[model samples]
Every structure is written in C-alpha cells, then in structure tokens.
Target: MGWLSMPLSSMHPHSTPKAYLDAQLTYERVIDEPAEAEGEGGPLPSRKGLRVIASSCLRNKVYYAAVAPTTDGVDGPVFAVVCLVRWNPRAKDGYVFAYKDMDETAGPNEAECPERILALLSPTENHSALQWRRRCIRNLARPTAKLEDGMRIRFASPIKFTDGYEGQEFFVRKRGRKTALAISEHGSARYRVTNMARMAFSVVPQTKVHRTVF
Candidate 1:
C-alpha cells in the first residue's frame, strides 16, 4: 500500500520529548535570530532568539508560529519563520517553547518545563479515546459511524497525558442516550464530556463488535 494507505502500525510515532525537540531543532536554528540589522528596516525587532507569535490548540493538535533569523544575506532584513506542530488530545492546551529560554550555564533541567508542556500536548494512546476520535471523524466523512445507547461499538486506544497535575484521557461517547456525539475525559472517577460536533448519535444499535480494535 502507498504511504496514505499504510496502517498506523507502519507509522513511527514520535515517543520522546528529545525526539520531538530534535525534529524542531533544525527549523529552530533557522528562525532564532533577528531578520535584519539595526540600521536596516526590518518589520520585526532584532531579537536574539525565537519569538512565539501564536500557541494554541486546534482540533487535536497544537499549532505554533514563530519568527527566526535567516542565514542568507537578504536585503531588507529577511527572517526565517517557523511553525511547530504536534498532535495532542483535544482537552489539553497548546504550549510554545521559546528558544530564548535555553541557557546551558544556569541550567538544572531547564528544558524540563518545555518538555512537560509537550507531554501535556501529546496525544493519548488509550484505546478508547482513539476509537472514539476515529468514529467521530468517520461519521463526519461518511455519516455512518454513529452509535447509540446499548450499541456495541469498538473503542480504540485513547490518548493519555500526565504532564498536568493529573493524568487524563480523551475519548468519544454517545450523548445522553441520544444520537448526539460527545468527546469526553476520564479523571478521578468522573467523566466530563465536551461537545465536539453538533451531530447526534444515531439511535440505531451498532452491529459491529465492541472489542478493542486498535
């Protein structure tokens, strides 16, 4: 099968904070400096390192946009902009790791904060969450994956996170015995649901097996 058709098993998901940081390092280098000289007319101020423009969560991913300096001697203070993106649970907040914060001398795991931030934004691997997310996406695309109360539907792995005060999981569930859909989180013996889409769950029972598929 082509890359698009390849199963998720074939995809090597990033598992560690270091790996994620490494993936971003090269791009970070390009954008961590001022675009132009002080005498030149650059739109942005001459910052020593990267500047975060936006850091927020969208769908199930964290999106970040920032500005960096360019190596090439382009006229009018050229700069290299960078975007740091990662898939995360829908419930978590997005975070930006500023390059200006890194200091080797006054460091005692200084990168730990950013690493924790990334971990918070990382998607859960819990089977239930993944299955629910997929079902919602499928419903949006094909309009047939809807589930109702008493329906036996398979739940996939959920996305889990522990960077915050407590660990959390994100999954999908039928809304109050109705056809409406909902995204939910499980923490401290309580389940809180968030309305991800307006479509209600179908009253029809699911014919598929309820086993953990993914």
Candidate 2:
C-alpha cells in the first residue's frame, strides 16, 4: 500500500495541534535531560534517528505539525502549523493539495485558484514547487472538471521551512467565493489568502565524500 493509505492516526503520533508543534522542543529536552539532571558529562545523542511528525488541519483556524528526534545528531526534523479551510459539508473528507513550479508563470492556462497566484510569488528555487506543481496538475486537471467548492488544497511541500529540520504545511479552503490560508502554529497567529507568489524558495544539494586511512 502507498504511504497515504496509512491511517492519519498511524501517520501521526502527536495528533493534537499543540503536541505536534512542540515535537522539536520535546526532542531537545530529551537530549538535555541527562546532563541537566545529573550534571554528568557525555557525548550528545545522535538526532538522525528521530521521526518526523505530521500536521493536521482543525475545524478552527489552526493546524499542527510534529516530528521526533533522529537517532543521529546529523539531522533534525520539524513540522509547521497552519490553518486550512474547513471540511466541506458537500464533499468527501479529504482536502485539496496544490503545487506549481516557482519559475512557472501563472498564465491563463493554469488553474484558476490560489495556486496560480502562488506560482507567481514562489521564488525560483522553492524546494518542493516543481514536485507540488506536478502533483496538483496531475490530480486536479481534467478535460471537464473544476475544483469543487469547499475542497481543501494542501501544498505538496511544506512551507516556511528554513532547514530540512523545520518546515510548514499550507491548508487552504474555499468558502463561498473567497479562499483563505491559515498558519496553524501556536505563535504569530495569522491567515492570508492562499498566495503562492509570496513564499520563499531554496534548494539543498547532496554531496558524497571519500576517506582514506593508514
């Protein structure tokens, strides 16, 4: 079965919005607990083993994201909070997920939604822009179709992320004629019209190395 087939309960250990957002702090404390309690000196624990948390959209203007610490300290994972559109009474329970290339222009040919606006705002290197665009176009495009009203749209890539360790998910809802995007985290509560054009973009490169010993 595919990853999406897994139940949300299974995919997310921290189901609540607050717990999900606090995943990073939880791991940090786990790393510091022994030292703070015993005043003993030891090597720091590896963070690479941590599990990434998933965020959920709530009925209100709130969202949650979560992740556990990795076993190796080389990498850390984090999730973001967002407010997405409420579930539609008229359709199935799932939400809409959208994507587009940062370099791609929002032309008349594109879907008539916030995604087009986002495409215009997204920076050239938005990490998941291309992947998201592909997913949205693939899933949303049809010869005789329209994005149903109240359908939720999730971004293929998480938003507002700096390092791989921390990222955000966007939840969008169409209510009547207006579409809104909400940031579901604890701090700095705010919502805006789903605008892909204003988001930041960056790319990370992978490298390989060789070592020799005598």
Candidate 3:
C-alpha cells in the first residue's frame, strides 16, 4: 500500500515518495529551468514526462511498481503537466473512477489535457497525422471505468478538439495481453510489448511544460 513496500532502492537507489515524483512530473520554469533532466536514479526518470511512475496493487495486499511508462505524451509537441494516480484495480466497485465523480457529467479539463504541437503543420499542410496524434494523447488522459481482461487504457468518451482542428476526436481503446501492451489502432494492426513492469514508450512526443499563474 506504500512505496517502500517494494524493491527499488536496492536496484535503482532513487526511489522517492509519490508526491516527489508528482512534483518532478510537473516541472517549473524558475526552479527547474532547462537543465538536463534527472537520471533514472532520481525519483523521476532520466526522461521526465516521457516516462510515468505507476504502481499496481494486487490481491496479496502488495503494491508493485509499473515499469517506466512509455508514452509520447500521446506524441504531442506541447503539453501541460498533469497527474494520474490510478487506484488499486482490486479495490471495491465504484472506487475505480476515483469514480466519486464518475457519475458527474464534467467536461474534460483543457489545462490538464495534452497539446499537439503544430509548429508549421496545419490542416492544409497535414491533417491526418495531427488528427491521429491528438487521439493518442487524448486517450492517455481519459480513464477507464472498469478494468477488463486484456485492457490497458480506456478513454471514457471521445475528446473533441475545437480550438484548431475541426472534427478532431482523440479516441482510443487499448488491450493488455498478459504482460504485453497489445494496442491496436482500430483493427488495422496491433502493437505488442512485453514486460509491463518496466516499459519505454516512444509513440508520443517528449513532454514540455509551462507554469500557470492564478
């Protein structure tokens, strides 16, 4: 039920608390400038945003850390730092969504939503790539109500981007086959990955962040 309960220090020696990891994930401009990111030894991975420190709890009442996350931040050129603290899958029903607000018809938080960096690539220049890329991140942000067999991520509803791309809905449904990340885009093809404990995702782009002043 805690971090020290696992085996990371003996191996990585940089195991910190979840709050520390959360702070790293949300980089700051003044305090964190553009210096070289921390190596894997630190609570945060050498590749900051690109990797997510996730943990899963089993019926045995022990928590196992997920391998470094492999995501492109959904391949976005620009994105904001957000946090996802997944509850134990084995927890009682109605607790999955953190689901207290599961029944609430709340809209997606734009500030927390991942962004697409279209330096010069516009709809006319290239729309297909931008559309698909957005979907990847949107899916990553969305949450799955219930955990099912062979399932990894499930975006509750399709996210619509109206700021730039029209009719752009980032939607995705991935399945986990044992230890492999069996993610299929529609039915075109499936990308399988082994070793769920530790993974490196490169599909999404690196994570760059900005500070918001309230």
lDDT of 1 at 136: 32
Candidate 3, residue 22: Cα displacement in angstroms equals 2.0
In the range 1-214, model 1's lDDT, one tens digit per residue, is 1111122222236433223333443232334445556666655533233332222222222222222333433222212121222332222333322122121222212111222223222244555434433443454454335433333222232323222222222234445553322333332222322222322332324356677877
- TM-scores, each model vs. reference: 0.24, 0.20, 0.17
**Given candidate 2, what's the lDDT at residue 169?**
45
Worst 10 residues of 1 by lDDT: 107-116
Best by lDDT: 2
Tell me, what's the RMSD of every candidate?
17.0, 22.0, 22.8
Model 3 TM-score on a 0 to 1 scale = 0.17
Give candidate 2's whole-model lDDT.
0.35
Question: Model 3: how far is 115 from its true place, Å?
Answer: 12
lDDT tens per residue, model 3, 166-190: 2212223344543222334243222
Candidate 3 — number of clashing residue pairs? 11
